[model samples]
Target: MYDFANSGYTTVVITAVFSAYFVGGLAKGAHWATLAWTSALSLSYAIVMLSMPALGAWADLHAGKKRLLMLATIGCVVGTALLAWTPRLSGTEAVIAAMLFIVVSNTFYSYGESLIASFLPELATAQGMGKVSGWGWSFGYVGGMLALGISLGYVLWSQAQGLPASHFVPVCMLITAGIYAVAAAVTFSLLPERAQPRVDRGIGAWQQLRSTWQGARRYRDFVWLLACTVCYQGGVAVAITLAAIYAEQVIGFKPQETMVLIFVLNLAAAGGAFTFGYVQDRLGHRLALSITLVAWMAVCLIAASVTTKGGFWVAAAIAGLAMGSSQSAGRAMVGVLAPPLQMAEFFGLWSFATRLAAIIGPLAYGLVTWATHGNQRVAILATTVLFIAGLLLLLPIDMKRGRAAAIEKSPA
Candidate 1:
């Protein structure tokens, strides 16, 4: 249920609706909106990357993961709710307000992901972690579909009533925020916190940082996983952040068409995530991730070459499949590799890698688009390179050694 609400925020606010509104409706042009959206993502990721390690370490040391998760969730909910007040592109002030809200909300959302993920190792055994993670992601996809469907219904109804879309966009934001808050509350109420062993309280942030740095040397395979994630997830972030805008500008998709496409993508992604969970457990994380990366590369190629709307839909389905599988495999790998006591700290690094990818991928695409006078096709093609690079890095990883190291290092 929590994943469902969180997925709603990502699909509706970040991926589909508000992103298009930011470029087409608010920023009033593709060029500025691209710059604004990427800039916001970059700034937010920068903050997350810098703070996550310390926060993760602190939460683990104090056994305060749940508390931190709650705090981050509240920040997200409040920031998302505030987006309801975004002015309808009347002027520069409105654009700035919208961007500010998105940045803050997105930061909170990222932090929540990291915090929640730290609990995964406690929730399931290594043999079953993939299935649990996959289920969560599947639920998220359903949430995404529900949120997008509601927003699409609103858009269709508003158009029928002769009302401009700008009037309904903010309402959609409010709905997303409400769903997230309510779902998160249910999760908080029902989920039990795992017990943590006592640790020395005198350990300072600097010591924690040094310990984490040293642990990286001890956990080389885990470090390799993080490196691979950086490359592939960078490409994934770019594809997700700009999919709607690309369809609208390049393929000439209307807002309604884009929503329907997103809805279908969510359904496909749910199946992919659910099915791949079994694959991850049977085939192992490295092999599963490699497969997904290949799929992502294929999707990028298809998206870049296809000129027809029908062709783009084919690419979207491939993307949805790859997206869910890749993310589920990555999280399961982290659960397998992280030392049980340091789960939060390792997941924090996971967030750092993901945030770094978020920063680099979007900024690269945004800059290329700006320089080429809004030519996004070339930018889209560049993402394939990231997937290829990630696959190369991942091929050398020793998943068995990584899991062994995690078990050896875990406190009894």
Candidate 2:
């Protein structure tokens, strides 16, 4: 539910409709403001990486993880709804408000994600964690698709009636917030809270967080998984951040066409997520991830070469498939490698790895576009290298043994 909530907001407000509205209508109608907006967003992600582990440690000490997640979601939803009023800002006001939105929303998302590792035990056995992760991802994509469809419907209706394009902004923001509220409610109602830890004065909060970091470093497989996640996840991040923009620029897709492509891709993603989850349960995480990586490599290559709308949709479909399988299996893999009593702490660090890289990926692609006079094919090629590298690095990890290690640490 958290994943669904976040995706609805991310797809509609952050990545698709509202961003376009902000770039064109807000910030006094300056498109260059997008760079500042994106930079501020990156800073938001950096803050999440820096603070989530500390927050996790505090939560562990106080048994307030669920409470914190609820607070974060409230903040995110409020900020998203408040975007309707942000169109009036200019100069520093515009930049600051945008930053606040990014920070609040992403902070909530990162915290919520930390709690997901807790679900691993209830949702799947060690052997079935991949499928469980896939189900979550599939739901996320479905949520995004639903939100995007609403946005597209609004766009088409407004256009047919000769209404302004920016008219959809407030509607999108409200829908995003509304969906997030639902997700949060569902999460609070359905998910079990982690038990409070006994007071142990042996380690200070900071000391415990440091110990978690040290443990991550000391665990060779964990370190390897982090490295793979950082690289390949960056590719996924960049692809998503730019896919629609690229389609618009390269294939001349209208918003309606773009939404269709997104829908098809996400549907494929949903299928791949569930299918790969089952595959991982049977064949294992390493194999499922390996398949996803290879599939992503092909998509990246195809995206680089393809120019037609048909070709773009094909690439999107492939990307969708890779997105679901890889992310779901990866989360499951992380669950299998995490310390049971410290799942939230470990997930916090893991979030830092993947989410921090997400900040880098888009900026890198934007810089590449600027340097090459809007050339993006090269960027696609470079991302493919990251995916391939991740696959190669993951090849050596023994998934069966990793699952055993996690099960051994879990409370019996």
Candidate 3:
């Protein structure tokens, strides 16, 4: 249900509505608009990477993952709502304000996302982790659909009434923040806190970071997993961050058409996550993840090759299938291989790896687009190499060794 809360923030604000608004509406006259938006996102993700390890350590030390989760959620909700005020500003002021608010909102949102995943190990056995993770991820996409549906409905109605984007888009921001707040409220009310304060070690976040680094080689596969995650998830970040823009630029989609395209992605991704959960159990996590990577490569190839809107839609659906399944598999893999006492900290490292990927991926695309004079096709096509590198990295991991290492106690 926490997934239900947060997906709205990502779907409406990051994926569907707000990114394009930041580029086209807020920074309308700038040649560097796309780079500016992507740079803002990269900066925010860098903040998360720098902060999450310590935050995760604090959550574990005080048994405050839920408490921290609440704070992050509230921070994201407020910052997102604050974005509604950006439409009222003009020129560089509007652009600067929007970018600042995005940094605030996105940082909190990313923190909440990582903190929530720390609970997966407590909720399910190792054997059932994949299925449970998949189910949760699948439901998140449903939440994305619900949020996007209402936002899209409002947008269509406002368009019919001849309302401009400056009017309707602010309302969309309010709607996104509202759903995130309400859904997270439900999560806080119902979810039980299971992690007890660590009485054995009273170290600070920096000490925890030092200890984790010292013993990193002991959990060999986990380190390799992080490397793999960085490569593959970089590609996923590009897909998520740039999809709407790609559709509008390459396929001649209007803003409405882009929203509809993402709406379809939510539906398709929900199915993919649910279906792949069972497949992961039957086929093994590595195989399931490999299948998704292969699918992602196909998606890039197909997307790059397509000129017509119909072909693009097909590529988008394929992307949805690969996106949800790979993310679910990766999270489950982390749960399976993290030490029990250090779940939050290890997942924080997981978040760190993903956050790094988030920075690298969007920035790479942005730089390419800027260099190419707005040629996004070559930029997106280049992302395929990240996935290929990730797949090759996956070959060296031995899950049995990793699981054994995870179950043993960490050193004093």
Clashing pairs in 3: none
The true-versus-predicted C-alpha distance at residue 83 of model 3, in Å, is: 1.2
Q: Which residue window of length 10 is worst by lDDT in model 2? A: 28-37
- Compose the digit string of candidate 2's lDDT tens values, residues 295-380: 99999889899878788778888888888888788888888887666666667778888877777776677676666766778867
State the lDDT of candidate 1 residue by residue for 369-394, as single tens digits. Answer: 88888888988998889999999989
How close is every model to the real structure, measured as TM-score? 0.98, 0.92, 0.98
Candidate 3 has a TM-score of 0.98
Clashing pairs in 2: none
CA lDDT of each candidate?
Answer: 0.88, 0.74, 0.90
What residue runs in model 1 are displaced by over 4 Å at the alpha carbon?
A: 197-201
Is candidate 2 or 3 superior in lDDT?
Answer: 3
